[model samples]
Target chain A: MKHWKKILFWGLAISLGLVISLAPMPVKATSSNQKLFKIQASRFAFSPAVLAVNPGDQVTIELVSQDVVHGLSIDGYDLHLVADPGQTASMTFTAGQAGSYTLRCSETCGAMHPFMVGKLQVGGNDLLWRAAGLALLAVIAGVWWKRV
Target chain B: MFAPGESRLNLARLRVLDKLIKSRWPLLLARSITLAGFVFTILVGLLGSPVGSHNFAIIFVWIAWWTALKLFFIPLGGRSWCSVCPLPMPGEWLQNGSLLTKAQKSIGLGMRWPRRLRGNWLASGLFLLIGIFSALTLTDARLTAWILLGLLGTAMLLSLIFERRAFCSYVCPIGGFTGIYAKTAPLEVRVIDSDICKSHAEKTCYTHCPWGVYPLAMRDSSQCGLCMECLRVCTYDNISLNLRPFGSDLGQTNSITRLDETLLALVMLSSALSFSAVFIGPWGWLKSAAYDVGSTAWWAYTGAYLALSLLVLPGLYTLAVWWSQKTGQAKAPFKRLLADYSQALLPLGLFTWIAFTIDFAFPKFSYVLQVLSDPFGWGWNLVGTSGVSLPSALLGAAPVLQVGAVVVGLFWSANLSQRLVAKQVQPARARRAILPLAGFSLLFSLTMLLLLLG
Candidate 1:
């Protein structure tokens, strides 16, 4: 190969690597796992799927995915973590807004993938929350294989 | 001594027929595996739901099968997939459902008038579109699954409406790419006895070509689907699957005209660029934004990316050829000569594909594979790893094998180009042909850049 071609090849390779590695890391937003929450990252169920946390409260989500890999992504927040089998990835993010938030699985699981979801009803009456939890649990248990 | 209208079986055709009759086990195995894989891919895409991560597996299957056919079988079998492709099953059965004995071969749809549009161009264009689509929606499992089902459906519809294998010949992009790339394949179906074919009457081989490619046109061996319909139907039985030199029959007679050759070269380069932008470009942020914001801008970005990827590279390549010829003091007629030799770039494109597999397909060096698959999660997963870390032995072996394959592929292409040039150039002044060879080298360099960057 000619000298110019070799130079061009190496230049492109080096620059690409530098760009990927040198890109600034994302800023860490306020998180309350000081407000601890067990994120059951299993197939078909998010154990304790409904969580009601006050605004500015930092929440820690401990992730577990039973089958394949699952991702815990709460849109509009910085809780994007992939939960692998037998491995739990924890992400800490605060509930900065006081609106109803959706917790959706970022990674693809089989069949009803789009429907694998949970809801975080922020600053609601505690009584209505309990009833929704009971119903969500029944659906989860029907799909979940784990006895607990 | 020739009987006027009587058909006779000759030794060459007899050999091919006897092989086809006896090779049922291999044929059956090939059909069963390909059909099962095709069915399984579609089912998984539809029922299980496709996601971004699983698209890699789909790509793996698609690229692996394509590579296997183009690199190894094209030279060997000659459109052998047609004999065994599962796509034709639904159409054939629909035309002659279940009652095998009563069903006639003709569905009585009379021949449609030959339109000015050629089938090969359509087939190639369609394949190019699919390839671009696959790369863009790489992560969308559902989309991948839908594309698979859609392609199969299109093939069935076309086959049902048109006579013979028009779907395979004209519409399916994969088949089109295969037909072109197969030119470089070393194995070909050939007449074992020339004397036998010349003497035989009632030309069954010419008439029964399932893809409707005339046997006389077998000089352009790249286009032969190797469906073996001619072999099966020939009374003379004169064809044999012979191991010939790569591109041997491609240069024998011209099928792809100069203009067509230039268009194909453009298609190949643009497709490669389009693929690379996703895998290697700075569009990662935009891609993430699409998923996050669900903005309409994502769609526009994707469209622009594809247009640039599939169209720009080839356009630039043709422009370069024109510029090079003009500056090289070559006139319009000489420029046309350069364009004719551009068909030689087909091998260069195939070489790019080989290099791509070497760079991207090899699992050990692929960082993305480590992030996605959890191999130990499944008892005996065909794809995936126990850990992200590579085993030295495996990693060492893969790149070595891949580079070796790339080197071998380059040499194969170079040899093919030489033969093609020899055929295109006038016999007396053949030695003076230099400009196109330089163009080929430049294209090859660009391919290497794309591979490395990929």
Candidate 2:
């Protein structure tokens, strides 16, 4: 490799490493005791698209279908239920996972049924941070392997 | 440090693989089975319930076949799927005027294909158009049926008008990207020795290759459809199906580069990102905009989609290339550098597609079983699995898999970029040229990670 190319390669690699390692840690808030939320499902959307709660919180959800029959299925949780039009279904569970889980429509309601999605954010979401760190490590290791 | 052509394992030397490749019946049988499946999918889509999840047309085509092509086929077999793809079968049969036997003469009009339409521009444009309307095609059973029927009809028409496999070569949208990514696949069709090919009087392999690729001068896997035509026609037994390292073609400098293919690569990467956002992301308005085709919001969405795929992504890549050249003090032409560096995107593009596939397919895999029992959603339980609803247990591991995919793709691309630069400039200048390209790959990987994990 040419002199400038080698310098730029190592320089960028080190800078990337420092930036990732020195990045501020994600804020972890204290756990809340209890929370109750009502989520509404319509033709192809959820009213409360994002529901954020602390880990270990006792959460109660009232899901209502507005226009048609729709089902709510949340990833990382065994919560799958269908609600008919103008009907409300109730469920309660303790939020234990510290990550973001997708809440999607289980039933095929319309042409956009596959894309009807929401997010359930619980606690600190350490997984995202860990993933970022792993990605940086993988890049550094890859560059090093090429050099070797 | 390693040289090209260092590690290639010939499958022709293997007893069973050789037997299968040399035989006429195995490929025919595979193509026949897929043809039956293709007919079944189209029929069910046209005649079954409009509900996508309950219908076999939607479930089998979108969930099962799409997943298989992305997750397994392209990664392991390259354009091996094209060997058995049913789309070109009817056209080939009609053109040859034979079902199982090789014809002494083809039966087409033999009109020469338009010279300007020779590249992947049409395929890329068609692919972008399809991506623009994927919201409807993936969900509406009737629309899916129409698209499939349209592809089959076009293939037949083109075969009748022109000579060999024009649809597969430059018209099919699916073939466009598959051919590009197939270059990264470990499997390749190549000659055992170029010396024999050079001295041979008759070029039987070139004449028989349906995809218009000559095995003697074949340096890349992009054009070879793995149809096994060359293997049969090589009287000297010079052709061999080899298992090679992944991204081997991308690392070499001898391969021809085209702007359309490079744009296709960026389009694929952008499409993957856009698909994840529209389908998997928690965005309701985006979904509504995408689904409502003629609405004002849909037009806005389309504008944004085109801008992102055609302009923004390529603009960013151009900037990286410009920076690399400026910083490295290299004197290579701008267009040449642009094309060469664009090849580095293939690894990342393919793996990002796999990541997206894992996210989309792994969750709804049980639907495959449901549709198997009740194809038309008519309450018939033919296979006793109509009521089964197995949840996606792989959800927890999905993020990790996606991260691994993007990360692996980034590093592989970075390595290839470095190799590419080294071939053009001095060692130090090559390192400088590689830096910006590496940074670009890292940035793209980080963006993908954010989309996937965040």
Candidate 3:
């Protein structure tokens, strides 16, 4: 490979990585209208494994434990609640994230407690597209380096 | 064939490192410390609290040690952990009838290892079996202890039945992947002068190689356990620990092409994907099925897991290799092509494991500290750290780290594929031959990125 080509190749790769790393994340806009969900937590799973909503929605989650004490915590969202058996624990927050965030069981319930998880899809996520584009760029870069 | 820019710097020229490798006491002392820790881990697992987070066995073994192994050891020092692994210590001592000295006579049956059961086939199968049950073992203290005990028992039985670390060479599951990834590590134990080894008639190095590797013929670091036995036994002082560039051994085709190792690579890649889905993905049904051992759902899950690992991933890889062969107009056999190209996945597999470990182990590191103060969760507060709940600040940087790892792995594998194809065909055809495998590697990277960031 030529020296200039190597420099160009690395420069492009670093730039692409930087663009992907520094890309501005789309924030979820707050709205006055509210969306309510009542979720039931059992021994090893939740009632609904996936919750999909549009951006800018004020989401209110009413969590009730069906068996023992369970806690619901969502990553990328500061939403956490603990509910005992037959009791409803509610939390209201704006769903402002435009990606998939993991909803996990916070409390140690049983043997399979660590595996108990759900998904919250806020809106159309662009991170996947950017990642796919970066991968494609890598292949092209590899081919170019080989030819040079 | 070797990489173009590869070079080795011998560490034997350094006085301290040479003395350390030449002497027997340092390695013995290190192994003894690890053995003590291993015994304590087993005891805690058997008698400690059932909670996975609060128990020293689960926290130390699964979180702390696992993280260090994946993140630092394998990449920096090939088979370094195996040098100090305590599982084979009892078996080795029993076989040699000594603790810190060289053996005068064989202690076990000393039967020849069967030729048919050689290679990595058994180790690959054992690795898959362990992976299938890892969901259960990683979370349950009792199960983890039993698994450790089972490994120790198997090692001892094999040592008594065979000779000279046969269990590690043929059947150990961790050894299977460690040997494969060790090729990419920066450290290697090799003959400083091959001519010296060839001219020497006695072949003293072969007699001391516990891993059954011949230093004279060693062109790669895959089979060497880095135990420094050859270093201690070399009469001419020909053995030297050399520092080389990472991925230096990946391009060496002399020792890397094998069907069993190819399958092991594919299995490791597929297993990483499946583990990520089961542990980190937001899917409750998959978790339930994996957790339920004997249920119909679990059976179905197992079926899917086997199909994906043994058939689907290998099938896709075969297709890619066939496409590359057709493009390159190579005359090599299909099996040869499959084996040769599979080496490209080593970097990606290793980095995927590292990325997965970063995601899985980092957030849970607080458990390590928690267990330190109360190893058995008996409210001991030994170190006044029982109430410590140090939240990980690494969550925000995890996605970037994962993406970087995947990208680096993709490029490294791509370079390796290019070199491998060039060795097999014309340089112009090599460019075309590398495309299919490079595409496959890129696709895998994209999939990993999706799993990590999307």
Candidate 4:
């Protein structure tokens, strides 16, 4: 409970947390490039479920419905597309936001309609890595609190 | 620094609070309201739209009630929901032969729950049964209604056969869920003084408790339903509702741990992991398999699910406990030690569910509003805001929040594990003894993180 020690531990914690969150990831980006994804939407899934792209890249998606009616909406971005069976709809947008966005089925497909989702990885998914860092810090802090 | 659940701020000292708890009117009123809601949910589930999101029974029951149970009720108000739970209300009314008072002409066989069937095995088994088919139950509105009907029927049947709240004590999975996690909530109902009880002739609290928990014998908040019957019935003014720190009943070395309760905790943990995989992960084939019950793929899914819950997780936890015992060289019997230490898993398991709620429930919350306006999805928009389908408000913060919640749980469990080992092992070996348990917690946390956000 000493103020100095507590401050020191927290200082280290905050610094480590910031570093983990903001530090350029090893796989972040070599160069910005155009990215295109032809995503197939079925009853409850998107083929190539995860789409990886660099931040600031021009990203275009060609959404194709394999069966039934399906739609794709990217979370954190105002982009949506719907297609009928054996039809194609496309949308083009710049991948301006970094981190991960979930791709959800906008249309009510079937039983597992709510759960049909994919991931849009813009950069290195720094949030997850930062969270992992913070988790480690939480354990250290917990153990340290008990010890001191 | 102090005894578990010992640090007290007696909430009963507040006059308004005292009155609220003492009166039967408030509890009766609350239970009546929930009973109405429960009946309405069953009706809507049976007669409303088949779609999960658009149905009141599906959205309100699963999304709203289930989420609230995990995030708020169990964590903040231990067994408080049980105090006003409508599932037992119908039977309780029949038992009392009145709405808000004990009738002279009571109804029931007044038989005791079999000692052989005592403990949480039935509750955990019921939870496993429900979880095995969660994909269907969670999605199909009719199935949800049928399940609710079945639960109500059983509660009523047990009330007539067994004495007091036997369905709640030994049957309801939801009750079991709350009872175990209620240990971490910072509230408890206990006697102000034990000598007062000993000096008194009539033990009103024990005689009146619906859950059959004797107030003086109660060591934790696990069994107490917070009914306040004891609080009201006691003339000596001996019962006190105290506010204490979290983890108050957790990891106390002196308390005896029931194998059933420990197994319940493990089952809950396994179920959380399973839920994350089946519900949150983007595995369409797996989801379809789980939903398509009785198919070869579904049988495969059930096998894997059973193996994980009944065998893998428990086996792994046992191995970890055995390692801790070997390294610490503690003399306690293996099952006793396992049960005792399993209390550490409470926060871990609870937080996993909380994070799961964040992922599974938070995004679909708009559906709560949607269903409110259109309960049956029969095109009658009562609120005029029916067409509004806003995306997740927590879209950006959900992952960060989920991660924070999970790690905090791991931190709590890790800290508790260390303390539990320190009580048994020498200070020099305490860290080593706790390593296995710590590793187990970390592994569980990481797996959840993977399923939730990876």
Candidate 5:
């Protein structure tokens, strides 16, 4: 209700709008991090199960489905990419943080499609500090509740 | 100020806005606009246009209705949306051209059917079940599609049975939410010239009420849907819709009297709590149980889910009261007070649910993207070519935001209990309500934190 609060609210709203609308693109020099990764969406394997990338590094993923069409959804991130059979699908996004994440198959590919999962780990991001803060808060609350 | 069934009321002497609303044109205008909007939404859904379902306009309609009902209804106008609801489209159609009218009239099921068992919690309960199922199964798109289909079926089936737009008024969780919140809206239809109503022998409004509610007993805002049907049927031009302050009826006695409404309030609160706990928990086990096929440990998982949903949360409040009584505390009935307290959280829970839908559900699976891709003639791309790695910091903040929501919800419940008990108990007794409420909120939050940590 305060003037400053209104301004801050609008500022945050605008930034959120921009983030949701704009697709993540290569920000740094493209050639420096131009490594292509092949992800074959076959029966039970995703070829290279583990992918390693660096912060601010641009990488292309070429995906082809050997059997049925499979969707790749990443938890904790806004990525809704899908691949179809025979046709190759590709998209470029920067691996902007350091953490292990599951690239779960969203589309019902087959009987074991639910188990068709892959991993991605990025290096160089201050994720540790935030995780620590969460842990610290939990610890403090636990102690306080016990004392009560 | 008029008592039940009092024909000579002093409502008209109160204002000039009454004189303007006595006109029939206003009633027609309001009904037409509402009907247009309702028809448009249904048509758009039937067209199966992703843009209509996915675009901002549809979301805005639901959000605006919710916001208006919550902010305006409790303090202002009651049962006002009922005046403008376009639910009896099928009934209206049947009256116009259907050959079944003769058979319907001849059969004469009549009004003698007992009104006591008229309201059912199962309608709202089914709605809640569907909502939970949708949340667990798929995100927004599938859920929205399912809701649209369900509405079509409800409209079709309800038109045939129980007579006169009964399903929407007596059933429908969404309608119940609107009816409850409409208590806070700022405008209402009242008898402007009671002298005319008194002089006229025929009570047309009573007979014409689409939902079969007696117009004379509609002094309370809770049962009134603000349909202005009474206004249209009044041959003497006695009925008038007038603008007034919000929550004007809150302090007034004889507000809402139905036990079914109390049941509805309980259902709303429980559904909200169940949704928050199940979807936003900190236990990896819950997620595993939900998403992982083999994680189902049969009875243990099923029992825990049932106990948590139906018993544990509600039981905690009951237990608190038992504790209070054991400590030699004299007070009001705990069950009734808990019911009222939980109902107060309905608005706050609705707000959080909307936020969750927007924050987590909307951005994830968008039908709009799928439709837009169709123009390029690329049918379905079902493979993940791009790696997914959102920052942990952002992902980690979600559980905390959810915790904040739960805390706010609990405090609101506590405040409602205090208000309800103000007349029956001392301030100390009223304050006792906060302890149990806050404890439950904290417990739920910590359980969620553990779920997230896993």
Candidate 6:
């Protein structure tokens, strides 16, 4: 085994790991995009299923319950907002993560309570694209290594 | 260069490990505990809460055991779980008319499995059946119990009618699931020297194997159940519980491939993709359609499910192989190429499942603990822990875990696909051949990443 090649492989692997961890959140935003989303939560469905906001934005979500009691808890954003029937609850947080975070129903709303989900995209789901790049790099590296 | 089994570290060489495997008592004990637990789970499912999370049957079977089976057992031990699988316990005992050892006379008719129904065709069908009804069967406690009961009854019936473990070898979806991915695991049971086994006049190992695997012909870990019966009955002391490199059986030049096994691999891939979409995905319409059995929505869901698994996914894979053949200008038949290149799907499928299990079970892990205190969910807190639930185990780390797992799988698959192509074509042609598979794998990995994180 070539020590330099081994070092290169580990370096590439570590780079991929770093890319996955920090891909979604890129360099600190120079300009912030502020946006407010009023999402309707009803019967295991979220209105405007995909909410897109740029990174470094003051994102405020006004969660309105059309029926029953529901909660909005973003996976990356720890703040959770709950709304009773016909009521609205709001949560404001800085959109720091750039990946797609699932907004799940924190409270049991119905039979499909466990699966109540919506997507929160801050900037873009750059992880997917970065992952794709790393995947190709991996294949190329593998082929090159196997040949050598 | 080390030969396949030659490179393997023989665990059976250690006296304690050898003794544990050679003795019948250890296996019997494991089977008994799982069997009793299985029976109890059935009873509880019949007489338990309608809510899925509170029900022991749903929690343990779908979330707990299913998660463990994918994330731990299959990755670590191959068919190690099958060694102590409880569904075959009673039937196997009846077949041999003995609990611990093989009887002089057996009860089964000793008939052969139908040749047409052999291979993974039946197993794939059985797996699709489970996949299509997964919503109802996974959630409803009574339905879950009935499915287990049905599988038990079928295993017993098959054991009585056929020679040995025919259901597991041919019909059990979980068996097919394990058997197909077992090649990726590090642990394998192989003959130390095939010549030794062939020379021995009394091949007691073959007769004793419940899976009917002749150790001499065991080229891979795909068929052997890791039962250890061969180890005990090997008069020549030829059987070796070899710990080899992970995925040591994959992409082998001498390995045999078949259309049936290839289809099984595709079915597994499709199942993982479909499951990720349905179970962990935020699509309410899909979940509702899947759960509402016999409804119009469900019919549509079934159609989409079947089409995804049967037509779309398999069609893409076939196209990849066709592309590989066309580009490489290989002389092998298209059908043969399909079988050979399909090895790329195994690592991808296995890791996809591990990621899916992580997403599906992380939040519901609380259900496992909650049910432990109240198996029947009749407001009985036997351990004073009922209604207590923990937060999601991985929390925000799940996406990271999911992404990491998928990337590793894609890398492995890419590596394997290149080697598989190189086995046939010249280096230049191999490069062209590998492109399509790499593209296919990369595309699939992105889709999964999108589902998991995007």
Q: Identify the runs in model 5 with alpha carbons over 4 angstroms from their true place.
A: A1-148, B1-87, B92-108, B128-161, B184-203, B214-216, B234-259, B273-306, B321-331, B364-411, B438-454
Model 6 lDDT on a 0 to 1 scale:
0.84
Ranking by lDDT: 4, 6, 2, 3, 1, 5
Clashes of each: 27, 8, 1, 0, 31, 0
TM-score, candidate 4, chain B alone: 0.97
* Model 4 Cα lDDT, one tens digit per residue, B215-280: 999989989999899999998988988888898888787556588988999999999999888888
Instruction: Point to the candidate with the largest lDDT.
Output: 4
**lDDT (C-alpha) at residue B429 in model 1:** 37
Ranked candidates (TM-score, high to low): 4, 3, 2, 6, 1, 5
Judged by DockQ cut-offs, is candidate 4 incorrect, acceptable, medium or high?
A: medium
Task: Please state how well chain A of candidate 1 matches the true chain A, as a TM-score.
Answer: 0.59
Interface root mean square deviation for model 3, in Å? 2.5
Point out the worst 10-residue segment of candidate 5 chain B by lDDT: B99-108
Fnat, model by model in order, equals 0.01, 0.51, 0.40, 0.41, 0.03, 0.41
- Candidate 2 residue-wise lDDT, B143-196, digit = tens: 999999999999999998998889998999989999999989999888877999
Docking class of 6: acceptable
Q: What lDDT tens digits, residue by residue, belong to model 3 across residues B1-454? A: 1324548788877889889988889999999999999889989999999988778998899889989989988989978999999999998898888987547975788887898998889999998897788778888898888989999999988888887888898999888888889999999887776888878988988877787789878777878889998888888877878888898877765534589889888888988888888887766688878888889988888899999889988888998999998999888787888988888899989988998988888667767888899998788889888777533233546655766677677777887888788888777687778888997888777777776655
RMSD of each candidate relative to the true structure: 17.1, 3.9, 2.8, 2.2, 10.8, 2.7
Give DockQ: model 5.
Answer: 0.06
Which candidate comes out best when scored by DockQ? 4
Q: Name the docking class for model 2.
A: medium
lDDT score of residue B204 within candidate 4:
85
For candidate 1, write residues B1-454 as lDDT tens digits.
Answer: 1123423223233455567544435565676677777787665555542443333334334445555654555435546666677776565545443212115555535244256545456655665656545443454556666777777787667656776666676666666666666766665666656777777776777765656666654556645776555666666656655555556544443433445445655566556545544332324343333332235665665566556545565555556555544444443464465455565556556655555554344432332353235311222335554245333234224323433333344444444444544555453433334334544444444444433322
lDDT of 4 by residue, A1-148 (tens): 5878878877876787678767876764457688889989886889888999988888889999999899998778877799999999999998866788888899888878988988988877777777777777766665656575
What does the lDDT read for residue B420 in candidate 1? Answer: 44
